[model samples]
Target: MSRFLYLDNAATTKTAPEVLEAMLPYFTEKFGNPSSVYQFAAENKTVVDEMRKIIAESLGAKSKEIYFTAGGSEADNWALKATAEAYQAKGRHIITTKIEHHAILHTAEYLERQGYEVTYLDVDEDGKVDLEELKAAIRPDTILISVMYANNEIGTVEPIREIGEIAHEHGILFHTDAVQAYGHLPINVDECYIDMLSASGHKLNGPKGIGFLYIRTGVKIRSFIHGGAQERKRRAGTENVPGIVGMGAAVKRAFDTMEERTAREKEVRDYLIRRVENEIPYCRLNGHRTDRLPNNANFSFQFIEGESLLIRLDMKGICASSGSACTSGSLDPSHVLLAIGLPHEIAHGSLRLTINEEISKEDVDYVVDSLKEIVEGLRNMSPLYEDFVKKQEKNV
Candidate 1:
């Protein structure tokens, strides 16, 4: 396409140039198995440890706490499943919100089938988990609480520190899927009382197929994969050296630019939200107004289908998402929207735009302008909209 505007950074981001540059040497000249005995390979192992230290420092954690995994999904699985097995003697119940990513939700389901109990907590309309409800959900058998740091669809930032405190108060382990909030927000594991966290490289402009699970020192969790003594025997398979280097570089770059980048993103994001609310008729903005990610703007246009709106935006060279990219292909409405008390029809009309620092006010204006036209055209063809308009005219 001659013109392209990518507003789907939540799905994935283009690897930053600096990250790619750092990774290039590893793929060619420095290619060596970190698990080998030779000096070349031993040096690679040192680099791996250094990358781990970088990731740890970002989270205020120790290098030994970070375990490399294939991606966020794997990390999430390892955190939940392994925690369950390790603590099964102590408890068999787990707690999580209804709006978590499928990686966590599906894993919870698997745990249920395996004879474990799970409590799916409710959230407010703004997608904030009810702290009181959380307190009530904690039983003696509740071993773990897994909540996402920030939502991928609506961009609602959860009360992570508070949740972590609650989990600790109950003497239970807490884990957060920080795939969306890692590079975008500031986090410190000790201050938050967080036992474990999962984050992905691709979400922060690093290479894909790489992620890390940070287990607090002395969590006593077993390995997810069984094989060679990679990741301190916590995870199997050879380390992705280039990916690790790229992730380290990306994390540092993200933090270095975060203050300025998110400040500008918030300014533009609020502008986009304001324009959409003022200009688009019958469209409702999702998520909290100010307590959300800097770049997330989600809206639900009444009497229009989300899929059709996405196609129209795509045709206009603007990319967005209906919900989470993982479930965009599915016809079902987002569980996140439903959990927040949205009706099925309204949820079906939802659109999520996660912009980057590069998106300007002008770009947002263009997107909002395009949205007005697309929503109007789609509503014209929708029988639901036709019926509603006829009733409105009769009342007038």
Candidate 2:
């Protein structure tokens, strides 16, 4: 393709040049195992410690609270499973929302199989968890409340502070999967009363397969992996020195430019949303319009299949998504859309476009222009659209 435009930042981001530069030395000349007693090797351990401090400071957490993991999924799994196991004596009930990432949902399901009672709370039409409903869901046996900071598919930012308040009032632990919000949104673990939070480097322009979980001191969670004394004897493995360096660089860069970069992304994102809403027919915007991630814009066209729309967009050299990258291979409609009360047919027609600092107004224009023509063409060929048109003609 002569021209390519990427609008799927939520799925993954391009690694920054600075981040790569920071990581290269670890793979070649500085290839030293952190656990080794030699000074050269143990110096690499200092690099890991420096990165932990960087990540911890960004979240207003102490350095010791951060534990590195392979990625967000592992961090999430560790948070849920270990917390459940650690606190089972106190309670076996957990609370989460219906629109969580599959990492959380599937883990919760597994917990259910193991004799834990999980209550999947519902959301409104805009994919916002109802605080009243959350309050009502709590019981004496509820040990934990896990919620995502934002919906990856729909872009709805949940009321995390409010949820945390509720959880704390009831003496329950609060864990948030902040994979989509860690760099994109400003978060303070202390200010939000967050007991545990998960974040992945790949979501913020770092290398893949590195993430961290921040556990409040004295939480008493068990070790997720058992072998060596890595990650403060909580998670066991050889330290990923290069990935840690890359993530530290990425996090620093993101935090340094967050205000300016997010402002630009939000402008482009809103422009795209307005153009699509004005030009596209029989479509609805998904998620809370104002209380959403700065770069996410999702829509559901009435009569077009999302996968077909995705294929056509790809042909035009545009990179977008129907939903979460994790579940793209599945033919099932998005659970987030269903949680928002959309019918199965409408949910099947969804599209998600997440922009980044690199996206421009002209790029959004090209995408919208391409979408207008593609949606019209797809609708013309759809039997469902044809039936509706015929019915309308008869009424006319």
Candidate 1 residues lying further than 4 Å off, grouped into runs, are none
User: Candidate 1's residue-wise lDDT over 1-396, tens digit each?
Assistant: 556899999999999999999999999999999999999999999999999999999999999999998899999999999999999999999999999999999999999999999999999999999999999999999999999999999999999999999999889999999999999999999999999999999999999999999999889899999988999888989999999999999999998899999999999999999999999889998998888999999999999989999999999999999999898779999999999999999999999999999999989988989999999999999999999999999999
Summarize candidate 2's per-residue lDDT along 1-396 as a digit string, tens digits.
657999999999999999999999999999999999999998999999999999999999999999999999999999999999999999999999999999999999999999999999999999999999999999999999999999999899999999999888889999999999999999999888899999999999999999999999989898999999988899999999999999999999999999999999889999999999999989999999999999999999999999999999999999999999999999999999999999999999999999999899999999999999999999999999999999999999
Give the Cα lDDT of each candidate.
0.95, 0.96
Model 1 scores a C-alpha lDDT of 0.95
Clash tally, candidates in order? 0, 0
Task: Estimate candidate 2's alpha-carbon lDDT, on a 0 to 1 scale.
Answer: 0.96
Name the candidate that leads on lDDT.
2
